[model samples]
Target: MLNGGPASDDHERLLLAIEAAGLDLWENDLVAGKATLPATRTFRELGYSREEVGDTLAFWLEIIHPDDRPAIENALVAYRDGRSDNYRAEFRLRARSGEWVWYANYGKVMSGSVETGLNRFIGVTFNINERKHREEELARINRLLSAQNQQLDQMNAHLEMLSGTDPLTGLFNRRAMNECLHRLTRSAECEAGVLFVDLDDFKKTNDIYGHDIGDILLCQVAQRLQSCISADDMIARFGGDEFVVLIHGRGEGGVRTILEAACERILNILGQPYVIGDLLLNACGSIGVACFPTHGTTVESLTKRADIALYRAKRQGRSLYRFFDSGMELDLYNRDSLEKALRAALKTRQLELRFQLQVDRNLRPIGAEALLRWHHPVRGLIGAMEFLPDAVASGLVHDIDNLVLENACATLGKWQHDPELRGLSLSVNITARAFDSPSIAPAILALLAKFGVPPEKLCLEITEQLETRSFVTANTAITHLREQGVRIALDDCGTGFSSLESLKSLSFDQVKIDGVFIRDINTNTVSQAIVAGLIGICRAMGLQVLAECVETPDQMEYLLEAGVDGFQGYLFGMPLPCAVLEAGVRDAPQSQRG
Candidate 1:
C-alpha cells in the first residue's frame, strides 16, 4: 500500500503479473529454518484455502502425492548443496476434494554454500494436468495397438500352415513337398531318397463303392502309411491315389535296405482290409524308389524317374515295388520305340495272325487259336511277349484286337468251302482293353457277317484278369456274343485273380488250364491235384475244359486221363502261317480227322 518510489512500483507490477498468471510463489529461509507461501491462490484452486498454507517444508510435502514426495525432496537437497543451481520437478499433489492435480514446480537457490547450508529458495508452481492426461492416453493407445499386432502375427502363421497342408489327409501338399525336396538337395551332409506310391486299382474302388467310401479309404491309407514310416521321414499326398515319401540321413548302401523295408511295410499295411461302413475291402499299393544324386539330383528329375519306376511295377503286375535303375531309361526308350512300331505295324500289315491247332482228346484237330505276331522291319520277328505290354500301355491293344479279329474272320470265311477245314472253329484272344469298349460285341458280329463266316465257327478268349475290374459291361458283352452263337472261353485260367468266381458269374463256354499247372503235372502231385480240381470245377459248372502247354507224352496222357476235352501246346504243332495250316489240314491222314 504504499510507496510511490520506483522499487515499490516494480514490486507492485511483479505481484500483479503473478496473480494474473495464476501462479503460486513460495520461499524457504534457511537461516530462519522455515518455508512460506505468501499467496495461497494456487493451493486454493486445489480445494485448499488460504488458511491451510503451511509454514514448514514438511507440512508443504504432506500435500504431495506419496509417489512424488521423494523426487521433490531430492531436488531441494541438490539445489541447497550447490550440486544444482535450480530446483525443478513435476509431480502430483492431492486436493481437498480427494482428486490429484499435476504441478510443475521450479525454484532457484538465492544464497547457500556447502559450508553454511541454504539461506533462501524461491519457486513457483503451475497446473499441467491436461498435458499429462493427453500423454497417458497416447501411451494406452500404443499398448493396445501392440497387442493387436501380435495377434495378427499369430493368425498369419496359422494361415501359412493351412496353405501348405492337404485338407483331407492332413499331409503336406505337392507345393510343400517340392519345397522340401529343394531343401534336401541343398544340403550336403546326408543323401535323400523319394518313394512314389500309387494305390493299385484305386479307381476301380471308386467306381464300385462310390466316392465317399473311396475318400475314407484314402484317409485310412494315409494313416497306415504314416505309421509305417519313422518320425524323421516326410510323407506327402501328390494328389489322387498317389503319395511321395522323402527319406533322409541315409548312405547309398543303407538307403536301398531302408527303402525296401519301408516299401514292404507300406505294402503290408495297405494290403490289410479296410472297413468302411459295413463293408470290408482289400487294397494294395505299388512303390517306386529313387535316390538323391544317384537316380537324379533335382526334384523334377527324381520325381520323373520315380514315376517311371512306378510304371514298371504296374506293368510287371500291381502290388510290388521297383528301384530306379539306369537300364530303366533304356527300357523306357525301347518301350516307346516298340509302341510306335506296333502302331505302324498295324497300319502297314506287318502284324500277322498265326494259327495254333487245338486237338481233341483223341489228338484230332477240332479248332485253331489265332496268335498275334509282330514282324518289325528292323527288330525282326517279335512275339506277343515282346510288344503286347507296350501295346496295352500305349492304348493300342483295342486296335490290335480289332485287326486280329478282322483277319481271323476273313481266314475262316476263305476256309468255308474247303472240305478239310469246314466247320473248324477259330478262337481269337481278346484283351482286357477290348472289353472296355462298348461296341466290341457289335464290331465282332459285323466282321463275321462281312466275311460271311458263321457265328458258331468263331470263339472269343478273355483272361481271368477281366474279373478284377468293373465287369458289368464285360458280362453284357459276353451275353450278347453268346446270344449270337459265339462262344466265350476264359483264357489262362488258374493264373489270374478269381478264376472260379469269374466262371460262376460270367457266361463262359470253356476254361483253358494255364501252362503253369500243366508244365509240371507229371513231376508234381500239387500240380496234378490243382488240375484235377480245376477240371472237376469246370465240369460241374457245365463248361468245356482244355489243357494248354501239353508238351511231353506224360503231360498229354495225364491230361487225357484227367478228362480234358481239348489240348493246345507245342506237342501238337507250332503256330504256323495260314497256308501251312491249310496244307497240313488237306494232307492229313483220314484217321486224324475229328
Candidate 2:
C-alpha cells in the first residue's frame, strides 16, 4: 500500500474500504509489460480462478472486447505519459459466462520507475452494464418515436391532397382554385387569364342518362380541358358541371391572345363527342374569359367578370366563348332586369302566341306555326327567338314552352267549328329544354285530350340543336309523342350542328328547310341548289318538305316548282296574334297576306 514502508494501519483501512465497495483495482508496469490483479471478488463474479485468468495485461486486452480495446489502451497511455490528470473509459468485457458485461476503468499514476519515467498506473474496474442497458432502451424508444413522427407527416400530406382534390374528376376543387387564384393575383406583374367553362345542357344529360353517366362526362370533360392548356396552366373543376382554367400569359397582348386560343380550344375539345359504353354523347362548353390586370386585379373581381362573360356566352348561343368587356357589366344588368320582366310576364299572362300561316303550294292554308311573343307593357312586343336563348339561361324556357303548348291546344280547340280552320294543323315550337323533361309528352297528350283537339293536328317543331345535343332524349320524346299521333317536325333542318346522320337517326313527319336558305333563294344559286337537294332528300325519306322564310314571289314560285309540300314565311303571312287568326283564317296564297 505504501511506496517505501510496510502497509500502515490507515492504508490497510483504505484498502479494506476499496475492497468493501466492490471496486476491482489493478496496476500496470509499462516497462516490463506486466500487470497485477487485486484479489477482489471479481474472480468469483466472473466464475474464474486466479490461476485460470493470469495477471497479464495482454490477457485483459484480449477479452476487453474489440470495440472498447482502443479507447481503454488510449486512456492508459495518456495517464502513463502524464498527458491527463486521470484516465477513465467505459467499455465491455467478456465474462466467464460468455456474455458481455459493461465496465468503467479509471487510472492514475501510481509512481515512476527508475528504469522508465511514468512506467506504472493503477485503476478501478466497475460494472456498468445496468446503466448501459437503460441507455440502450431509451435510444430504441427514441427511434420508434422518430418513425412515428415521419408517418404522421406523410399522413398529413395525404389529407391535404384529398381535401384539395375533386373526388370525381381528380382535379382541384373550388377551395384549391380559390387559393391558387389568390396567389396568382398577388404575384408580381400578374399576367394571367381565367376561363370559366360551363357545360351546355349538362343537366339534360343527367336527367336522360342518370347521374353516373353525367359524372363520367364531367371527368371526360376535365381531361379535355386539361389538354387545352400548357403545364403552366391549371384546370380545376370549379363546381358541378363547371370548370375553371387559369392560364399564365407572360406579356401584354399575349394574355388576351393566349386566352382566346385557350377558350377556343376548350370549346372545340370539350365539344367532341364522348363515347361512354354503348352511348355516344355530345357535350359542349361555353367559356367566359377574364384577363388579369385587364379585367381586374383581385381574384374575386376577376372571377366575377369571367362569370359575367360566361353568362353572355351562354345567352348569345352556347358552345362559344366570350371575353370580358366593360360593356358586359351593363348587359348583365339589363339581362337581369329582362329576366325579372320575363318571369313577371309568365305570371301575369303577358306571354301570348301569334300564328304564322303555313300553307300548301296552291296557297291553301294547311296549318299555322305558333310563334311566341311577349307583349311587354312597356317594350311593346318581343319575338321568341330574340329572348328565348336568354330565357333558357334563366331557366324559364321550359315554362314558356309549356304555356305555348297550352295556348296552341286552346287555339286548335277554337278552330274546331270553322270550315277553313278546322282542317288546319297547329305547329307548336318546343324548346330543347322541354325535351329533357319527362313530363313533356304526357303534358302534351293531356293538353290535347283536355281541349278536345286531335293529336294528329298538333305538329311539334324540334330544332337540330336538340337532336345533336342528346339524340337519345330527342328520339325518345319524339317516338313517344309520335306514337300517340302527335306529329314531330325537324325544325330548321340542315342549319345546325346536326348532319345527315341526324336525319337518319331521328324519325320525323316533316323537315322545315331553314329560313337562311330561303332568304337568298331568288338570286343565290347556291341557296337554291341546297334547298332543292334538301327537298329531294325529304321526299326520298317520306318527309314533307316545308320551305320557311319564303319572302319573294320568285322564291315561292321556285319552291313550288322544286316540289316543296308546304310553305311558310313573310310572303304568305307575318306572325299574327292567335285571336286575329281565330277571327277568320284568310291569310293564304290567294291573298298573299295575313
Candidate 3:
C-alpha cells in the first residue's frame, strides 16, 4: 500500500478524497515563494475541464470577492506560517454561473514539509453559500419583528385610552372618575378638590328640542368646561347632566376659580338662545363645590357633602354655584331637633288646632280656617310658618301633617255636633311639602276615622305655588280625597304663580284670593281689579271664591261687590283661641248665624 503511518495514510486518503469528491485543493510553498492548485471532480461539476486543473494561485484568487480577498489571504498566510493551525473565513464569491453567493470557507493545513528550508501546506475550500444566505434572511426577519413589536406597544396604549375616555367629548368616563379619586387619595402630597356640576333642567332641553340637539349642547358645555380648567386638571362625566372636576392644588381658591370660571363660561355660552333647526332653546347649570381637608377628608365624605351642596344649589335656583358651607350643618341640626320635637308634640298633644272664623259678605260668620299652632313647653307658641320649613327639611312634615289633620277633624266633629255650628265648614291650610309624602291621603283617611268627622266638613287648602309646580301629583291626591267626599280649595289665588292653568288642570271647590291682593283692595284699583278678575275666573270655573285680609269696611264693600263667596281676615277676627272661637259661635244673633 502506497501509504505512510496510519495517520499519514489517513491524510493521503483525505487529500485524494478532496480531489475525488469534487473539491479544489491548493498548496502554498512558503520557502519557494510559489503556489499551486489541483482541481479534482469538483472542477468538472463546476464546469471546469481537466485543462483548468493545472492552475496557479491567481486562478483561485479570481473567485474571491474583492473586499474579502485581503482578509482571506492574511488568514491563509498566518496558518501556513504555523502562527495558527486552523484557518476559517467568510466571504462572497462568484459561482461558476457568474452569480455572487455568500459563503463561509473553513480549512486546515494537511501537512508541512521542512526539508531544504521549503514548506508545503495543503488546504481545501467548500461552498457554504446556502447556509450563509439563510442566516442573513433570518437576521432580517428578526429586525422586522423588533420594529413591529414596538408599534404594537404604541397601539395598545392608544386602545387603553379609547377604553377609558368618553367618546362624545374626549373626557374621562365614570370609571376614570373612580380611578382618579382613588389615585388622589393615594398621593399623600396631592391636595384634591371636587366640583360637582349639574346641568339645570337638562331634561327640559332634551324634551323641548330633539335629543340630537341636546347632545350638541352638552358637547358644547363640555368643551367650555374643559377649556376653563388647566391642563393638569381632570374632568369626568359622572353621569347624565353631571360632571365631576378634580384638581390637585394647595389652596381651594385655584379649584374655586376654575369651577366658577367654568360655570360662568357655560352659563354665558348657554344663556344665549341656542338655535336648533327651526327652534331656539335656552338652558343653564348649577355647580356644587367641595374641597378636600375642608369639606371632607375621605372620598365618600367628600362626594356626599358635594352632593348635599348640589342639592342646596338646585333648591336655591339654577345657574348658580355654591361651596360647601359649615353653616349648613348647624341648620341641619336645628332642623333635626325640630323634627324630633314635632313628632313628640304630635303624640303628646303638644300641637293645637286653632280655628279662625270666616264670615260672609254680610259680616255673618259662615265657616273657619283650621290653623296649626305648636305649644312648646319651653319655647312658647310656634306657628306653622316658623317651623314648617324645618319640618320639611328634616323629612318630618308627614308626622306633623297627620297630627294637624287629626286635631282639625276632632275639633270639627265637636263643633258639628253643636246645633249652632252644624253648618260650618273648616278650611285647613296644607303645606306643599305635605303633598310630597305618598302617605298623605291614607293619613287623612285615618284622621277622619280617629276623630269621627265627616269628610264633607273638611276642606284642604293648598298654595298656588304648589298647584303650579305639582299639578299632577296634587290633582291625584285631591281627587282621591274628594272621592271620599273631602273638598279641595286653591289657596292664595291672584298671587304667586296663579293662572287659569291651575283651574283647567285641577278642579277645586273654592279659590281664596291671596291676602296680598286683597289687603289694599279698597285703595288700590289694581288690587280690586285682580280680585275681581280672580272671582270672575273662579265663577266661570264653577269654583266658589274667598277674599283674604278683609280689614276695612271699604275693603269689605269692595269684596261684596266682587261677589265674593266667603271672607276671612282681621275684619272677621284675628286668629282666635279655641275658647274665643267657641264663645263667638255661641253668642251669634239668630239671623246672623255662624
What digit string (tens of lDDT, one per residue) describes model 1 on residues 36-55?
Answer: 54436667778876557666
Positional deviation of 527 in candidate 1, in angstroms?
Answer: 5.5
Alpha carbon lDDT at 589, candidate 3: 83
User: Which of the numbered candidates is closest to the native, going by highest lDDT?
Assistant: 1
Ranking by lDDT: 1, 2, 3
In candidate 2, what are the lDDT values of residues 1-594, reduced to their tens digit? 556455677677887888888688777776677775552465567666777667666666766789888887787677656687798899987789988888887877678753567667787877778899999999999999999999989999998998899999999999899999999888877689899999987887888789999999998998888888888889888789989999999656688887887777788888788999999988988989998888988889999999999988887878989999999999889889999999999999999888988888777778899988999999899888778877887889888888989989998887786766788899988876677777788989999999999899999987427545566766888899899999988888867557466788888899999988988888898888888888888888999889888888988888888899889988877898776765546533446432
Per-model CA lDDT versus the true structure: 0.85, 0.83, 0.74
Which has the higher TM-score value, candidate number 1 or candidate number 3? 1
Clashing pairs in 1: none
Q: After superposition, how far is residue 341 of candidate 3 from its true place, in Å?
A: 3.7
Where does candidate 2 clash, by residue pair? none
Q: Tell me which residue pairs clash in candidate 3.
A: 22-42
RMSD of 1: 8.0
Candidate 2 achieves a global lDDT of 0.83
